[model samples]
Target: LLLLGLMRDEDTSDPEPLDRSGVDDDRLRLVFTCCHPALGLDARVALTLRVVGGLEVPEVARALLTTESTMYQRLVRAKRKITAARIPYRVPAADELPDRVHGVLHVIHLVYTEGHVASSGDDLLRVDLCREAIRLARLVADLMPADAEALGLLAHLLLTDARRAARTDARGRPVALEDQDRGRWDRDAVVEGTAILEHALGLGPPGPFQVQAAIAALHAEAPHWDATDWPQIAALYGELARIAPSPVVTVNRAAALAMADGPHVGLALLAGLEADERIDRYQPFHATRAELLARSGDSDGAAAAYRRAIELTGNAAEREALTERSRRALGR
Candidate 1:
């Protein structure tokens, strides 16, 4: 995670005059324009990559595997709409910060998710996006240093990215955490993230992002997957679910439960989630379902769930891993 690139540069223009209160108006305008609610989620993400990352049009096209012309058109349209909406560039007022911050966090999540489980292109991991997102998050934290949500978000990304070196194999295949070579983990990043989490805790009460960061910190401290404090992780996930209850969160929490209690317990928890229409199309739900079923000795059901997960998402790495799991479950 390289948030080091947000430093002020000679190429960047000087700050403009602030609004009535004398805060830098140009900076505030950039934030509002970058995270404008009117922009579609995908559009917002793309625009942020271009503007914040200072990526060349061709570089973005290469990263996303799209043509330069197409990316140019998209950016042009996005700029016009932001200008039309007259969104400001600075951080939102206290009353509006929550919604604005959520937009920024969502963009970071989207970028890291793409890196963790790339949706297209030949590579499974897009380290560039992950690093870029971390860089952007650092900028956000700098802009709102006192904001616990922003700091927690940065910490979460840092800790998660710290495990990147161990997430896959030499051939780019998926490596389950239990089987990963911990020696390859980025210890420096882990230490940095833990420090950031501590700083975030000192800021204010814990939020969903802080809870998630705590879970990541736990993982970072473990010497091996089996050494992971599953019970603590489960509790953290519980807190996250309470603060930001989503079917996906519950599904992930179930995985920790399976590790903490038993496969049967996790199976029971997941049973109630089958009707969670909010994440019906989400890949992790079926992936978790398959894992629980396999651990519960329902090989047939596990295989079916794995197959369904593969069909639901086009992320090559995840799809490949799902297919492999399905084959193993069926003893093929």
Candidate 2:
């Protein structure tokens, strides 16, 4: 028989040669592979951003809102785990695509979320993280053209990013969506995102991402806050709640209800969520509650809620914004 032992040794010993010209493809592969289901979600996201997104350890730490030392240790552990487990650095095969794709999507979404709202940084938005996320999302959508959710996610991120210009004032204070100057929005991103959303919606049944993109599209198309289709947005949020059913989604739904119906209706909805221990410390919940209370003429209660929100968040910019809101509430 042939020297089968020697052949096996060669196969095991030699690593595949790197293709330098295909750096972007390699990065994409690294992200998808690193975000494998076998790894912890947190580790997967950190490693993917660190390695594939080519973000420095400190930048990754900032995006994740953790210390650099902790992030470095986490990255070291992830690489060690990958090597020990012999996790391949290639994309998943067709049979294993679904689970791997979901993991990758989840990691990308997390990255985008951090970029959209820096969890602990002084800056209200991390443009670099947002750009990285959008780039990765576009790559994923291009690679999986048939994946409706991928397209929807890409569209959703683009639509959100399109508003980056108007998200804050010249003084770096956060601007409410209604108060943002529509003229400052990115028309190119709006066009592309709307087109992608339409394509995604055409491909399959409306998933949570698609629904979210549709809602964003509505906001993008509206000329002014008063022109927004609140009833349609409320309906979409209702559908998203049914499909996704998260506390965050419920909060958003409550906001939409407040817009569509009245402040009292939203306040009633939020009253049920106030006792939920899981989200009691979540800043958005308190902020939304403050808004609803303010709209309902409960200035004292709104001020208290705003103060609680300001206390819960670590981002200095976010704290400043909330403090301003609290001051306004107290003054009212």
Candidate 3:
């Protein structure tokens, strides 16, 4: 939803460098206002978590034990009500800001996730969304300088966004991470990300964002794909699974395990999720499964998985890429 972008349109320009030196209590004032009382408690809570809490629609669905399609309908219904009622956005009182900071962090997180890889778009990445999310995350980190999660989330975005230049090829076709040219990455962003990550980890116990930042930090620190500390990444993913416990996290952990351990190790975990139905339509799950199956020499299975992934992909080029992978799997 547009809510995942800027809370308002006017904040789009970063005319000058951001100030991270002090706290701004009202940095995410709009986040608290999103939980308007007119909406039903469940819908408000879900919407707040989505708009403010940073949870993805699918993750919120899982929290409610409902399908994402069902959850999306509820979200739409809530938004319509808010719009019809002309709900006002107000900054929370200073006393109320503490309770809502976590939700604001999530808002930034989900926005970045959507921008990192759009759910439905011709383009693989939504640069506008990424920029907005990063800007908001910077604000939150600056305002809540003592909050580790805020610092971790900012680090995560910076570390991940650092690869934007190499994520696609000269022709704009999305390149797989292993195939991406590391030399093209933004070194400045990586340096900043690692520095923030170190400071965040030193603050206190790691939360989901900090753990994820650690994982991204490992990837950023690697000189090359094979040089990546996959075992450490896998371990961090395991920690993240404990902290977040979502299908996305689970799938990612499996992928990291595949890199750290073997294709078989990843396959074993994915096989358990195959019957869950909740992730049957999730493109990444199918894509990851297809790759692992291909590595395990299950040509038929790989081809089937790849076709499923292709069918689920919204991007035309990505569909074509998956189709090509399927063909190779069948041939090999």
Winning candidate number (TM-score): 2
Candidate 3 wrong stretches, greater than 4 Å: 1-32, 35-72, 80-88
Q: Which candidate do you rate higher for lDDT, 1 or 2? A: 2
* Global lDDT scores for all candidate models: 0.74, 0.80, 0.77
Give the clashing pairs for model 2.
none
Put down candidate 3 lDDT per residue, 157-178, tens digits, no spaces.
Answer: 9999999999877766788888
* Model 2 per-residue lDDT tens digits across residues 1-332: 01112223333655643433233565566776678677887789898776655557876775554678989898888876776665666655555666677678867877778778876768888888799889888887876788899999999999989999999999887898999999999999999999999999999798888899999999999999999999999999999999988778888999999999999988888888767765765778889999899989888888888878888776788899888777776774
Looking at model 1, residue 274 earns an lDDT score of 74
Rank order (by lDDT, best first): 2, 3, 1
For the record, the alpha-carbon RMSD of candidate 2 to the native fold, in angstroms, is 6.4
> Candidate 2, which ten residues in sequence have the lowest lDDT sum?
1-10
- From the highest TM-score down, the ranking of the candidates is 2, 3, 1
The residue-by-residue lDDT of candidate 1 on 41-137, one tens digit each, is 6567677666754556765554454567878898877877665554445556555656677678766665666666666555667888788678767
The number of the candidate with the highest lDDT is 2
